[model samples]
Every structure is written in structure tokens, then in C-alpha cells.
Target: MIREALRKLMEQAPLTREEARQVMTSIMEGQATPAQIGALLVALRMKGEAPEEVAGFAAAMREKATPVSCPEPERTVDIVGTGGDGKHTINISTLAALVVAGAGVPVAKHGNRSVSSKCGSADVLQALGVNLDLDARQLSRCLEAVGMAFLFAPKLHPAMKHAIGPRRELGVRTVFNILGPITNPAGVRRQLIGVFSRDLARLLARVLQQLGATHILLVHSDDGLDEISLAAPTYVVELKEGDIREYRIDARAFGLSPQPDGITGGDAETNAAIARRILEGEAHPAREVV
Candidate 1:
């Protein structure tokens, strides 16, 4: 069945949600060989997953994820993004998580270290003194105390550890990049996700629906940055009350000035410093980057 599924995907034929779910299950359960995994992921990349396929992949990820519970008034939202921006912008979503949590909505932000860029979300947060080594219970407690939680990606999805070599070997963007956002361990009902590409926003919103997310904002910054960008038109795929809405968000609507400047850093240290000044709410490019 796995071989046939791989063959089908290789042929660029879209899988039904069930078929894709089984493939994801097989992959996550160690049921597929390295060669088979390579074939499956490559086939997926070549064909590109449809919304249904994305939905199935998200379902299997959520099913296998180690669950973490949020406290009372379960209206929690995850501010996470797939961070291979290669643009080295400061941690926008992480900063947004802070403000969103401050605004009374419970937040659980999933993040990882710098892979493609100078400083990823976790890098900047760690620089700011957020203990990245918290256990699951500690993670929950942190959320209850501050209305926010940050689940380090590898810690929450240990299964992905085995795929690190495979993903790194592939080197460029693969199916795994998108999975990071869809597998938030917090089990929140709503989220704000930023995809690296505009085309991915719509596809991810559909997958979010299949994964049981009730309310979500899938976003792409028009200037190729993820998250909401002030300088460029923001592309969005919003899920509300079971309906999918796609539109552009200009900063003028929020009464904020728009400025998307070139964000280029030599390394993580440089980027982390930028994030520090921004989180301090000081005047800098990092503020706009957020």
C-alpha cells in the first residue's frame, strides 16, 4: 500500500485525505524505510500537496503529538511560523505572541532554532532569558502564569528527531517545513500561522481545518517575509466559524505606519541582538520587523 501510494504521489495524482493520512501515519510510526521516506517526501514536493493531502498530513501529526493541556478559558491561540525565511528578520511571531498574550488571549508559541536564517524565534527568545529547557508540566505552568507557552519544536515532536538527518540531507525546503506549524503541542483551538510563501497560506488554512483548528489566521507578508509585515501588502487565509476567507491586510487598516526594509544579518548573534532591542519596545528596525 505504501509503495502504491508513493507511486501515485510520484505520478502527481492527489491522494484522498484518508490515503494521505495513512502515508503520514506510516512515516511518523517508523513504518517506512529511509529510501521510502525520501521517495514519499520527494514525490510530495514534486507533485505539491493539495489541501486535502495537507489536511491528512496535519491529522496524523496531531494524532501522534504528545498532548499538552491549556488551562481554563481554553481560548488559546498559537503564534507560530515556518521559519526558513532566509531573510534573517527579527522574531516577529515571538514578539507578537508576547503582545497577544498581554492582550488577554492565551498563547502557546511553537518555535525552533535558526536553520536557514541568522536568528530563529527560539534563538531570540533564548537570548531574552526565556528558559528553553522547561518540561511539559513546566510549559503548562508557564502558560497559566503568563498567558503564553513556548514549546520547543524538537521537544514536543520527538519523532521528528529521527527525520533530522533526512530533512537536512534533502537540504532545501521539503514537506517537513510546513509540518512544524501544524503540529503545535498546546492543542489550542485557534492560531496565527505565517507561511514562507503566499501560495502556502491558503493550503495551510485548509489543513488547519482538517486538524480541527476552529479559528486561525494564515498569513504571508507580501514582501516575502512571514507574519504580518508593515511594509508590504499582507496576504491572508482566515478561518472563522467554519468559513475560509482570503484577503490582503494593509497596515493602514490597523492605523500603523508601514515600512518593510531589508533585513539582512550576518549571523544569529546579530539577529538576536536586534530582537532584544525590539522586545524592549525600543526604537529600531526590529520593531517594524515584528
Candidate 2:
């Protein structure tokens, strides 16, 4: 199956939805060898993944993840970024999740440890002593009680371990980075996704629309950060009520000055301190970015 798929991919032919789903299922079930997995990922990346392919891959991942019972899935939103921008900036999506939760919205933030960044959402959360090993039931409860839960990727998608070795050996961004933000364990329909590239912002919005997403906002900043940028205008692709629209927003609209240097981040400990200060109401540009 992988060989046939690889042949088509090598020919620059996109996989059908069913073909992509079957291929991803085989990988998750450990039927595909490491060499096949690496080849498939690279081929797909080289050809540029289509919406159908991403949706199919996300469907398989959702089917395999440990399911969490969200109280109101349509109202619940997951804020995540397809990392690997390599900007090493502060964790803005995670902070946005907290702010959204504070506004009384159910937020299930899905993320992993640092990958091509100085500090990831999971890394900063762990540094603050937040437990990353919660089961599905506990995660559900946390969402119900506090309106927020961090769905750690490895804990929710154990089958992903099969692909980790290949992904690490490759040492580059693959389809998994795109898959992570779309595969929320709780099955939330609403999302605010930050993509590393502008093309991905529109691509993912279309993918989520195909996946029957209720509402989603896909953002990419001109300054090369995945999250919305304070230094430059941010391109946005918003999917709502089944209509997808493209637009750009500036920080000045929100009465913010472009302080690009103010948003730089460091190691987990350093990001933790920045998070603490922002949460404590410190007047910093990172807070404005969030």
C-alpha cells in the first residue's frame, strides 16, 4: 500500500481521500516500516499536501486518539500552532488559550514539547509544574471545571510513536506538524490555528472546512512568526458558518505599537518567567501579541 502511494506521490499525483486515510491508518497501526514512513512524509511534503490529504490524515489520527468527552464541542476551541517556524519566539498560542479560557470559553490546547522553537506550549506548561500525563477522563473533567485542558500529543496519540523515529531522523518539518493542530483529542470543532506560512493558513482553513469544522481562524504573520505578529500585519483566513474568507489585520487596530523585539523568548525557564509576568498583568509586548 505504501509503495503504491509513494509511486503516485513521486509522480506528483495527490492521493484520494480514502487513499490518504488508508495510508495513515497503516502507519498508525505499525504496518508501514520506518523507511516507508520517512519516504511517504517526504514525498507528501515535496508535493505539497492537499486539503483532502490533510483531512484524511487528520481523520485517521482522530479515530486513533484517546477520546475526551467535551461538554460542548461546538463552543469549545483549541488554540494551537503548527510549530517549526524556527523563530524561537514566546509561546503565544498557549497564552491565548489561557486568555480565552479566562473569558469563560472551553479551551483544549493541543501541543507537544519544543520542536524547532526555543520553548513549546508543553515545555512551558511543564516548567510551571502542570501535569502532562492526564488521562482522557481527567482531561474532560479539567475542561468542565476550569474551562481549559492541555491535551499532550504523545499521551493522546500513542500510535504516533511509530512515526517519531523517522520524523526525528529526518530533522525537518513533516505532515505531522500540520496534523497536530487539527487532531484535538477532545474533538473540538472550533479552533484558532497559527501556521508557519501564509499558504498554510489558507490550506488548513480549507482542510478544516472539509472536515466539517464549525469555525476556525488560521493566522500567519508577515514577520515569519507562526502566531499573530506585533511587528507586521498578520494574514488571516477565517472559516465560519461554512464560509471561508481571507483578510489581514494589523496590531495598530488594537492600539498596540509594533514592538517586535519585545516578543523574543528563550528556554523553558525563561518562557515560564515571561508567562508569569504577562499573567500577572505586566505591560509587555508579548502580552499584546497574545
Candidate 3:
């Protein structure tokens, strides 16, 4: 099955939704060999992932994920980003999740450790003494208690274990990068997702719309940052009530100036301290970005 899929992909023929689903299911179920998995990932990337292909992969991932009950899922939102932006900016989305939760909104933050960046949400969270191994029930409780929960990807989507080695060995962005932000274990319908490529903004929005997302914002900065940029206009694809719209946003609109130099990140501990300063109401441009 994978060999045939690879051949089709090499021909630049997009997979039908069902075919992608089957391939991803097999991958998750440990049926595809590491070589096959690598080939599949590279093939899809080279072919330019179609919306149907991304939707299918996300559907299969959701089917295999360990579920966590979100408190009022319709009201809950997840803030995350595809991490291979290569900018290594401070964990903006992670900090945004905490800030949104603090503002009395229910949040289910889905994340993993650093895959392509120096520090991912889980890495920074772990640096801040937050436990990442919580089970589904415990995650639900955490959400109910503080209006926010961190859905660690490895813990919630154990099926991804099969592809971890190949994914690491390949060391390039693949379909899994797109899949992560869309496959929230808590099943929240509203989300704010940052994509590493502007081309992916509308593509991801369409994929989420096809996957039954109620409301979502897919963002990418013109300057190549995944998160909205202070340096340049950020492209936005907003999907709300089944309608998708595209727009660009600039920092000046919010009385903030472009301080691109302020956006920087180091190790987990470094980012953790930056997050703490923002949370503590320190006066910094990063605070404005967050």
C-alpha cells in the first residue's frame, strides 16, 4: 500500500482523502516500515500536501489519539503553532495560551517537546515545573480547575511513537507538523494556529474547515515567523461559522511598534524566564507581542 502511495506521490498525483487516511492509519498502527514512512513523508512534502491529504491525516490521528474531555469544548480554544518556523522566537503561542486562560477563557494547549526548534511548549512548560505526563483524566481535571490544560502530544497521541524515529532522522518539516496543531486531544473546536509558511495559512484553514472546526485562525508572518510578526504584516486566514477570510495585520494597529529584535529564544530555561517576566507584568516588547 505504501509503495503504491509513494509511486502516486512521486508522479505528483495527490492522494484521495480515503487513500491518505488508510496510509496514515497504517503508519500509526505500526504497519508501515521506517523506510516506507520516510518515503511517504518526503513524497507528500515534495508533492505539496493537498487539503484533502492534510485533513485525512488529521482525521486518522484524531481517531488514534487518547481523548481528554474538555470543559465546554465549544468555549475552549487551543493556541499552538507548527514549530519549524526556524526563527526560534520566544514561545509566543504557549505564553498566549496561559495569558488567555488567565483572562478567564477555557484553554486546552496542545504541544510537544522541541522537534525542530530549540525550545517547544512542553520544554518551556517543563522548565517551569509543569508536569507533562498527566493522563487524560488528570488533564481534564487540570482544565476544569484552572481553565487551562496542556495536552502533551506524546502522551495523548502515543501512536505517533511509530514515526518519531524517522521524523527525527529526516529532520525536516512533514505532514506531522501540520497534524499536531490540528489534532488537539481535548477536541476543542476553536483554535489559533501559526504556520511556518504563509502558503500554509489558507491551506491549513481549509483543512480545519473540512475537519469540522467551528472557529479557527491560521496565521503566518510575511517575515517568515510562524507567529504573528511585529516586524512585518502577518497574513491571517480566519475560519468562523463555516466561512473563511484572509487578511493582513500589523503591530501599529494595537499601539505597538515593530520590535523584531526583541523576539528571541534560547534554551527551555531561557524561554521559561522570558515567559515569567511577561506573566509578572514586566515592561518589555515581548510582552506586547504576547
lDDT of 1 by residue, 1-290 (tens): 57989879877898999898888888777878778877777888988878888877777777887777788435888888887666666677877788889889888888898777777778777877788888789988987998888888877777665567777778877878888888888777688888888778878877777676788898887778777877778899998867899999887678667655635554556666766666677897556556
lDDT of 3 by residue, 150-212 (tens): 999999999989999999899888888888899998888999999988788889888988989
The order of the candidates by TM-score, greatest first, is 2, 3, 1
Candidate 3: where is the Cα deviation over 4 Å?
A: none
lDDT of 1 at 175: 79
Which residue runs does candidate 1 get wrong by more than 4 Å?
262-266
Overall lDDT per candidate, in order of appearance: 0.79, 0.91, 0.91
Candidate 2 deviant stretches above 4 angstroms: none
The per-prediction tally of clashing pairs is 1, 0, 0
Candidate 3 lands at a TM-score of 0.97
Q: Which residue window of length 10 is worst by lDDT in model 3? A: 251-260
Of candidates 2 and 1, the better by TM-score: 2
